[model samples]
Target: MLPNYFNTKPLADYMRHDLNIPADREAGSLSAGRVGRIAALAAASSAAYAATGHLLALLALLPAPAPAEEGDEDRRTFWTDLRRASGASALLPANLRIGVVAALDGHGAGLATRLLGAFGGMSTDQRVATALLVGEHLTNGDDFPGPASTTGELWLRDVELTAWQIIHHHRRPPTRQAREQFREAWNRL
Candidate 1:
């Protein structure tokens, strides 16, 4: 359990107000239920991957509806909705998180990256909370059964690259070049 002094309100407010999560969502609440769920999801996803060695199968637990055609707008909508519904539960092990985001349509993937970027300036507690939320969202169970799509694999590569950017932003003091590059990428998206 987190220390009593580890405040989560700022992070929850950012997710709800800045990231645009619905005010009604439990993720936006200050209650321990939300934090507990985030921690539980992270621990569970980590344990599952350690035990099974099948990240793909674990990611498959999340709902990823296939597009009739690649890059379909409806599919993008599905991913966006999925992100909203799952909240910060989408951040899992690197392999699983990358797979889930890569499976999204371009717009959806862009949104995911944007959300990660938002974590760049937050406090450590907030970042931890955000990571937990994202991990849980992606690892949360669904009934869908199938391998990740070819497009998803290809997009996974891209997400991996962007995720590194997020890590750089979070782990170190920002550099001008890194900030500029991040802006350029966000603009392109």
Candidate 2:
């Protein structure tokens, strides 16, 4: 049986209620506005961008999530089953190659999408920091929001591999050192 807390809204409802998504916009039009921004990054990491965007759309179907408890270990290990079932890298960082790891639970994917939408209206440098934060939250370890689907499990690995890549490419810095500085500044923020 599915958990009572899972997100169960239709795309239109999700678009309306989602904090990051625009309520007035039609669901199909999401790809043109805020969500479109992420899609544009598909030029480089097509697989990653496509998978992450798909994952976000799937996640949007879920119900709103409960607040994560502080320092919740179960939350950190949330993606364990999906990771194993997909035969993805056991080393979280290896799957991400940057960081692994979210209170984010069911809401993480959607939040990440919104964060990419001009990164909460932040400056360019601040946006990179937002991506780094998204990578950390997504890879951090929380399991799936509710029960997993066969398709969800199957693509879990690909989602893990490229979600961050899509976010990273959105506001790519001129150099590695510059990106690092953004991370540092974001931490300060």
Candidate 3:
């Protein structure tokens, strides 16, 4: 069960912290120790995110957050909105929703899938961040709203479509069409 006071902001912090895992850094003789620490932190963050749903909500969820806005309330708010938007996208289809969030990490979709599998499930904060990325990317050249809840559907579609566009930006319409068709077929269940 989740902590009675858990909420979204700390959860988001945990998500960011987890994703910041220095997979590339050298794990010395303390490799096991390091991995354990990273995993624990990641798991905690994941759990927090899972508990809170979004950071703004997390602020209210956690029994008692730091008691200080940390002087970056605005930044936190932006991230919270991002998470909500991206998470909404993830609601589309398991594969595509996860795929878009993972893909935005600057690595390939395969890596994203692997990470998700390795982590098992995303914390609520993590989900929100993923949704936000997809949502922001898809809403290209448009203004995203503040605070209140918005639909993740638009974000989900936009992320998938944008990813397709990026991959086939240089190709002709036929190639793009084939890829889109394949994606649609795959997403159909």
**TM-score of model number 3:** 0.21
How does candidate 3 score on lDDT?
0.39
lDDT by residue for model 2 (1-189), tens: 111222222232333333255545455755456576434432333333344455455343322232346455553454443233223333232333222122022223433443233223454444344333334444445643422333343333344443555455333224545768989999998
lDDT of 1 at 15: 45
Q: Which segments of model 1 are wrong by more than 4 Å?
A: 1-113, 142-189
Scored by Cα lDDT, where does model 2 land?
0.38
Q: What lDDT does each candidate get?
A: 0.40, 0.38, 0.39
Q: Give lDDT tens digits, candidate 1, residues 1-189.
A: 111122233333444443454445765565676566556534533321222222233334334555446666654554555344334334322223443443231112333354445334455555444334434444344522233333333333344454544333223234446778999999998
Estimate the Cα RMSD of every predicted model relative to the unseen true structure. Answer: 19.9, 17.4, 18.2
Candidate 1 backbone overlaps, count: 14
What would the per-residue lDDT of candidate 3 be over residues 1-189, giving only the tens digit for each residue? 222333234333433454443434555644676567666755654532232222222122212212243665544455445435444332333333343333333223242233334223456665555555534443444454542123343443333443343333212224445768999999998
